[model samples]
Target: MLSLIVSNPLFGVVLTLGVYFAAQKLQEKTNFALLNPLLISSIFIIILLSVTNIDYDSFNKGGSFLTMLIGPATVALAIPLYKNLALLKKHYRVILVSTLSGVIAHAILIGLFTFILNLSPEMIATMIPKSVTTAIAIDISNQLGGITTLTISVVIVTGILGAALAPILNKFFKINNPIAQGLALGTSAHAVGTSKAVEMGEMEGTMSSLALIITGITTVLLAPVTQAIIHSLYF
Candidate 1:
């Protein structure tokens, strides 16, 4: 009976939503940076699955539906960008340059560290898109013949780290400009980081939203090229 319940797709969906909602409520009550919804919910689900001996394939049956929603959810971020259109136009060049640079630097650093650690070609490929949103990152990982599960895990960890640490890093680095803060957060952390940016200011949220979109596009376009380079150098 327990196995039967866990095997249902709706069970996976309900478990995911329930855990996330609980995590959100906990964060709201605590106002703690470390109690991130994504991080907490992921950990909860992992434990639940492990304890129940439920396989990933069973959970993913409904989880894939949630994954499918990511594309539209990303498109929704444009609403914030649209609201800040004038500001975006005023600093278009800065936004473009900063986002592109951040994306390239992120990829390069991941490759550099992976190579230095002597990670396998597959592992390196999985880590390439770790800074982007899970939707785009999974696609890129699949294209590169990397493990999507590992890519998603890396992306989640990166976003949580960015969201939790952005404030401290900003103060330490003396990054007071809203635009810079948003771009840095979004480029490095994706949607999870953008959530933290929203708490800072409207302009910062808008900029983070724009950065997330642009970074996703940039990473997708660059994935094949990066994969080829990795193959030549590592494979």
Candidate 2:
């Protein structure tokens, strides 16, 4: 019976959502910051796959469907954005400038690190878009000739870490402004981080959503330029 269920394509989808749901339940019950639903779900899924000896290719058969939902889920953020348009307008300059700065800084840092480490241009390409939303990052990585698989993995890790650390980091830095917090998460972590910001508050969610959009567009516009610069300098 277990073998039959595991062999089904939907097993990937069912198992992922099932574990995430269970993780969500735990988060609700425990109200622990580090007990993140996505984080917990990821750990449990890894363990399940390892224990069952299920290969990633087989799991991704149904898991790909969840990836499809990312676009629509990203669009849903528009609601909160609209609700907070006035706040966005009031902070438009700050949001715009901050996102732009973050993208530029991220590119420079990634390029510098890749150069110092003597990594390939392809790796530099893959690492450049790690901070943005997956949907947009995938496209940028493709155009930049990056390995899509590695890009996805790196992006996921970046998001998960961003989400998990945003709260703790904010506390440590004594940063309490909702707008700042939201932008920090969205700019550094993208959608997953934005999810955490949403849990923090409506203002944080809105700002994070706003930052996510801006950062995505900025990254799309500048990723190629950054890659070219990195290539000229290091490669």
Candidate 3:
């Protein structure tokens, strides 16, 4: 019976959603940043699969459907952007420049460090898209000849760290400005950080959504150019 249920595609979907819902409730009760729902649920899910002796391929049979929804979910962020049109217009230039800087800096640093460590081109390619949201990052990684699994892992770690540290970093740096906080989180952390920004305040959430979108677009467009530069300068 257990094996049969695990083999079913819907089992993966149900298990993920159920675990995430439970994790959210736990976080709500704990009110701790470290108890992040996504993070906790991810860990729990891995443990559950391991204990149950379930292969990832079987789990992904259902989980792949969830992955497909990520694209549409990303597009849905536009609704928030539309609602905050005036705020966005007010800071369009800052948003553009900040996000561009993040994309470029992220690319250069990942490329330089990976080359310095003598990582293969494929691994370097995987790390290049680590800052962007997974929806587009997977595609970027594939095109760059990266290992999609490693790209996904690195991206999640980046986002988790960004979300976890944003509040502490903000307090330490005395960054009170909502717009700057949002830009910093969204540009660095992607969607995970944006979720934390939403809890911070209206302005932070709005700016983060904007920054996240801009960061993704800029990364998509510049990844190839950045890759070429890395190839020339490092190789």
Query: Can you write out model 2's per-residue Cα lDDT over 1-235, one digit (the tens) per residue?
Result: 8767776889889989899999999988997766877678888888988988888888988898888886786677567668778987999999999899899989988977876898798898889999998888888888988999789778888898888888889999999999899999999999888988998998898889899988998998999899889888876
Candidate 1 wrong stretches, greater than 4 Å = 77-83
Candidate of highest lDDT: 3
- Model 3, 1-235: lDDT tens digits are 9889988999989999999999999989998777877788989999988998999999999999999997898788678778878887988999988999899889878877866798777887898899988887998999999999889888888998999899999999999999999999999999888999999998898888889988988898988888888887777
What number of clashing residue pairs does each candidate have, in the order they appear? 0, 0, 0
- Report how far off residue 195 is in candidate 3 (Å): 0.9
- lDDT (Cα, tens digit) per residue for candidate 1, span 39-67: 89999999988987899999998888898
Give per-model TM-scores: 0.92, 0.85, 0.93
Summed over model 2, clashes come to 0
Pull out the clashing pairs in model 1. none
Q: Which of the predicted structures, 1 or 3, would earn the higher lDDT when compared with the native?
A: 3
Better of 1 and 3 by TM-score: 3
Query: By TM-score, is 1 or 2 better?
Result: 1
Worst 10 residues of 1 by lDDT: 73-82
After superposing candidate 3, which stretches have Cα over 4 Å from the reference? none
